[model samples]
Target: MKNLTDKEFEQVIFENQLLILKICSIYCESQADKDDLFQEIMINLWKGLRSYRGESKLSTWIYRVGLNTAISGFKKRKRSPFIQTEELPEHSIDPKLQANQNEEVKILYHAISMLKPIDKAIALLYLEERKYDEIAEIIGISEKNVSVRIVRLKKKLEQIITKQLGG
Candidate 1:
């Protein structure tokens, strides 16, 4: 595996920054922690670039690196604080639906925050709409396992959201 040139590295980061940030958000409660995780992920990506054989899609490679860093950092930190909900990126939302959607997003993230580290990584990749095969590759799980986990994760998330909503 060849190392990415500086230009190539910057381009890769430009293309995938949001994906990295989302992974960080899954493992981090505070904005400061998220920022720290993001930086760690970037550093790992730079250091690991030479080893990135093209066995998987580039996005899959990025997911693999991002998730491993997040999970490892989470274990090392052993953070137990509650999720600190952040506002979603600005987008045109119907005024009538904004409040409901915002609350739902917050609840959803809170539910996600309660997940174990691997489950959080799985949930993030699943929510990103990755194909089951791609998710299996990124997570290093069997495709069948990815399918089963998604089903169970959905149920778990539903239960968590319902409990949070007092339903």
Candidate 2:
């Protein structure tokens, strides 16, 4: 049928998978957590698409819905039972910089982990190269707010990183 179950929906999902995956990777604490977050995003998008009128660009709607999915997903994951290290994936990084790469990424993610959910979304989207307007639109905040939050978030991230580095 030309309704909820169709190809166009899949197209939208496939097209946006990278954005969804990136958001999950940035927000989630671990690989299994990331996968759960991604699923939550997809389910929300699928559920929300039915009511998407033409008032907004499809990309805009996707951004909004996806961002909300991530925010709520992060919250749920926080309250739920989480996996221990044994549940983590064993994906390998580059051997040349393996030592430093994993440590730096873990540190970076740990720093990001400390942000409030909304600020986490803002910082993650900022890191994903979204324009200020797009970030604001996705976040339901003003452009100026996006900028301010980012500056504050950067300082917070710096503090976290500094502490992690034992400074």
Candidate 3:
């Protein structure tokens, strides 16, 4: 497979930025941290592009690289404070519509944030509707293990949301 030229790389990242951000959101608690993780994922993706051999779908490769970078960032974060010179700029998709959905999404993300790193990755992939085989491939786990973990994770999320809502 040919390496992506700089423009091609930029376009790919732009098209898939939301996927990267979703993974980041699962792993990061703060908007500032999500923004930082997104940038780091893009940098890592660019660097990893050269090593692409078309062994898996491009999206799978992106997921592997992004998740690995975020997990690495988690380790680095323990030793140093995250520094930010400016606050993340906010964008509203639709005021009323977003306001209604935001609370539920926020609660779900909070619950996901409580998961272990690998569990968080698994859950995010499941939520993204990735097939079992694809999730297994990306996570380097057996398909059956992915199934079992996702079952347990779903129950865990139910418990978390129930507790959060005092149900």
Candidate 4:
């Protein structure tokens, strides 16, 4: 694959920015850390673009690269204590539903944060409604493995939420 021209690169990033942000949010707790992770993912995307072989969907390629960068960032930093923040910047939701949605979002993110990095990647893709085959493609796992991991992850998430609620 040839290098992406500046315009093509910009357009690709612009189109998939939300996908990157969602991945960052799943991996990073604080806004600053999220911002840093987002930048790293973009850099990796730019640097890896030439190697993209057009074998997978563009979004799938983005997911693979973005998740790998995030997983590496976590491994390298190994930070135990994250600076807690109120929330990621809010998006416009129906005013009446905002509070309810925000609380649910917080709980979901908290539960996801407890997962191992690779499991977190699986959970994120599952929640995004990606098919098992696609999830496998992104993570380089077999479809069967994706199914097994997702089932285990769902059970684990239930336990986490139950514990959170009980406490």
Candidate 5:
């Protein structure tokens, strides 16, 4: 696209920034690490915007690029132990957040913590309301595998939540 305006670019970032942040939080082991990862994803997004070919939805492209960036960032950070992360930035808790949903969200994070590295990516996409097909494409997995993993993950998440709450 020619003559892309700055406002349009900023709007795209504004709309999807939360999605990137959530993905990093769910995947990274430490708060500082997540923040660093988030920055990397944002930078990659900005850089990749120019290469947009309209082959897929903007969200889909972002998912692919952000995830690739996350994987690479994780690898880089693994090699560098000097980086220290602070507490993760807090999002506003919804005023209407129910007690059960609050507990579930917490336990969900716990479940996410227990997921394997790649599974964390799948879980993040699913949580963001992505279709299995889209997730499969983003992660280079078969659609069937994505479907199967989501089913298994749902059960696994429930078990973790149950165990955490002494159920």
Candidate 6:
């Protein structure tokens, strides 16, 4: 693949910024940490741009880089054992929806935060309505694995949410 010019890189970042932010938010608990992770993902995306072969959809490529960067940064940082019930990064939620569904959204993201790194990635992609094939591609897992994991993740998330709501 040809090198991405500064303009091209900027355009790509602009288009996918929300996706990256979502991944960062899922992997991080605080705005400061999310900002740090977003920068890391951006740097990795810029560095990896030349290596992108267009073998997958551009968004899929972004997801792979974003998730990899988030998970790597997550592993390097220390975290509190308890799940953070704080709101997700502001950019991660729609303000219109937030007005009506704020608490439920918080609970959902809180439940997601309890997931392991790989499982978190799967959950994020799944929730984004990504296809099984695209999710598998981004996750570097087989389609069957993606399907199986989605089933299990649903059950687990439901349990977490139920427990969190004290049901």
Candidate No. with top lDDT: 6
Q: Which scores greater on TM-score, model 2 or model 6?
A: 6
| C-alpha lDDT of all candidate models, in order | 0.83, 0.75, 0.84, 0.83, 0.79, 0.85
**Candidate 5 ranges beyond 4 A from true positions:** 1-3, 81-101
Give the residue spans of candidate 1 off by over 4 A. 77-101
Per-model clash counts, in order, read 0, 0, 0, 0, 1, 0
lDDT of 1 by residue, 11-103 (tens): 999889989978977788766677667777998899988888888888899899888888765556545475443454344224465356587
Which model is ahead, 2 or 5, in terms of TM-score?
5
lDDT preference between candidates 2 and 4, better one: 4
Residue 164 displacement (Å), model 2: 4.1
Model 4, range 1-167, lDDT digits (tens) per residue?
A: 57878998999899899899899888887666777778779999998988889999999999999999998765465454663433434552234653566655777789999998899999999999999999988888899988988999999998888787775
What is candidate 5's lDDT per residue for 97-145, written digit by digit as tens? Answer: 5345577687788799898878888889888899888898889989999
- The C-alpha RMSD in Å for every predicted model, in order, reads 6.0, 4.8, 2.7, 5.0, 3.9, 5.4
Lowest lDDT sum, 10 consecutive residues, model 3, at: 89-98
* Candidate 1 pairs with clashing backbones: none
Query: What is residue 76's positional error in candidate 3, in angstroms?
Result: 0.3
Q: Itemize residue pairs with steric clashes in candidate 4.
A: none
Off by over 4 Å in 6: 77-101
For residues 1-167, what per-residue lDDT tens digits would candidate 2 score against the true structure? 12566688788788888778767767775667776777777888888777777576776677677778777656765676773323434452234653566766778888887777788788887877878898888888799988998888888888888898888
Q: On a 0 to 1 TM-score scale, where does candidate 2 land against the true structure?
A: 0.72
What value does the lDDT take at residue 156 in candidate 6? 98
For model 4, the superposed segments whose C-alpha errors exceed 4 Å read 77-101, 162-167
**Alpha-carbon shift of residue 42 in model 3 (angstroms):** 0.7
Weakest 10 consecutive residues, lDDT, candidate 6?
A: 79-88
> Candidate 6 lDDT, tens digit per residue, 4-110?
78998999899899899889888888676777777779999999999899898889999988988887755564464653434446675465754676776899999
